[model samples]
Target: MKVAMWSGPRNLSTAMMYSFAQRADFAVLDEPFYGPYLRLTGLDHPMRSEVLGDRRKDAIEVEQSLMDPVPDGKPHAYHKHMCQHMIDGIPRSFMAECVNVFLIRHPARVVASFAKGYPDLTADDIGFDAQAELFDHVRSLGQTPVVIDSADIRDDPEGMLRGLCETIGLEFDPAMLSWPVGPKPYDGVWAPHWYTSLHATTGFAGPEGPLPDLNGHLAELVARTMPAYRALETKKISQSMKL
Candidate 1:
């Protein structure tokens, strides 16, 4: 199976990728579209030059790679993607070929965490709108993409992962519960700039704390994103669901 996980920045996306990388049968691909996104947007994100230097900047080549065979002869491939990177220029046809899942988090949590590194954050920078649109796109393709929340996973990694596996017709492997502290070979070149807190932990953090208080631009961002978050939240795999 090829699992394409779509998510925004600071939405527990890296940790989730680490979890799947620990699975023996899985070959993981990190942010294949990063180079293309940086090239197209010219946003000057942290380590922009290095990111552009690391790989093919063509969306065509990157999308082709996503559909190609998993490396190392693995039985499955897990592609970690940033929702924001699915720009108008990137093709959506390949999504129908894989099982797409949307990973989400509370807007306040996302804003609180993402704003530190990207102080001049915008709604598009967080990718909530794109995530929702992609969700609809997948649905339009006759696939009911699974949606999972970061807080739910952190609250009970084993139970949530087990349930996620079952929902997707995959066996629940105990190995997905944790990973070694620090980076894995599959991490993207941008890992250093984005994965500092994640690199220190072997497992998901505890359940998310109270929604952070926000004001000014940050508060406005959450407000704008909440509708999309809530829309997907209604369709999420809840803790009360089968496990």
Candidate 2:
């Protein structure tokens, strides 16, 4: 199984990756696009190198490389990509084999975290619009992509994770709950805010402060993304009714 999990910023994406990695049969790859996006856009992100280090190849080179083909014959390969939007001028077929999951958080929470992590950025600067684009793009690909809510995952990890495994045709594994908590190599370069849950287990629980309240900016983002987010929710509910 080639699995690709997508999520907005500040979601428990990294922890979810850790969950999958706990399975002895699965090999995981953290955001392959982190490097390519930074290198391609030349954005001066705080953890620029950390995100893109493993993929420091030129952007055009990446475009060319992806155009070739994804190799077949891999089993239990889980690739986690924090995708907000599709890269322009790249082939969607490049990722045809992936079983897609979209992990989402409330915009209020997402914006609050963004504010804390980036002093210079406002909610306007964050790519909320890109998220809808991702929703539409993924919907166009598969019949039923698993859309899991981050809050639900955090609140009831066992049930949500068990259902997630069943949806993806994997046997439920309780071991995912107790994965060693710490930053692994594939973790985002800026692991502080993003990897907070992981670092908490390593004697750094002080950073697990209250979730910041949403400000005007985050409110705006929620309004913008609500339609797409609700659509995904409705789809999930409808699927569950049939099952």
Candidate 3:
């Protein structure tokens, strides 16, 4: 099975990828379309030149790679994707072929963590809008995309993971609970710029504290994203569910 897990930046996405990668049967791909998105948008992202050098900037080629055979004959493939990368030029056709799962985080937490890295950030830059659009698109295709909240996972990793695995028709594996510190072989070339904090941990962090205290622009950004966030939040797997 090819599992396409989608989310925006600063949403515990890397840690989720690490969790899945610990499984013997899963092959992981990190931010497959990042280079293409950077190339097409001409956005002045940090490490842009290095990212372009690591992966082909052609959208079609990147799409083809995602559809290719799972590496090393692994039984499943876990694709860690950033919703913002699905700009005009990137293709979404292959999503129908994979089990698409939307991973969401509260907008306040996203903005709090994100603002430190990108001061000029906009609402679209964080991907809440794009994620909602893609979630609807998946449903339009007659597919029920699974939605999981990062906060829930951190609160109860084992239970939430088991629930997620069952929902996606995969068995729960204890190995998914943790992975070694530092980068894995499949990490994208841009890991240094974005994944610095990820390297310091071996597992998901504990449940988050009260939402960050944001004022002014960050607060406005979170407010702008709440509708989209609540729309998806309502569909997330029940927190009380005892899987």
TM-score, each model?
A: 0.98, 0.79, 0.98
Model 1 global lDDT (CA atoms, 0 to 1): 0.91
Quickly count the clashes in candidate 1.
Answer: 0
Off by over 4 Å in 2: 49-53, 58-74, 122-128, 202-212, 237-243
What lDDT would each prediction earn against the true structure? 0.91, 0.63, 0.92
Clash totals for all models, in order? Answer: 0, 1, 0
How do all the candidates rank in terms of TM-score, highest first? 1, 3, 2
Q: Which ten residues in a row are the worst by lDDT in model 1?
A: 55-64
Model 1, position 30, has a per-residue lDDT of 90
Tens-place lDDT digits, model 1, residues 41-70:
889899888889997659998888888888
**Model 2: number of clashes?**
1
State how far residue 145 of model 3 sits from its true place (Å): 0.8
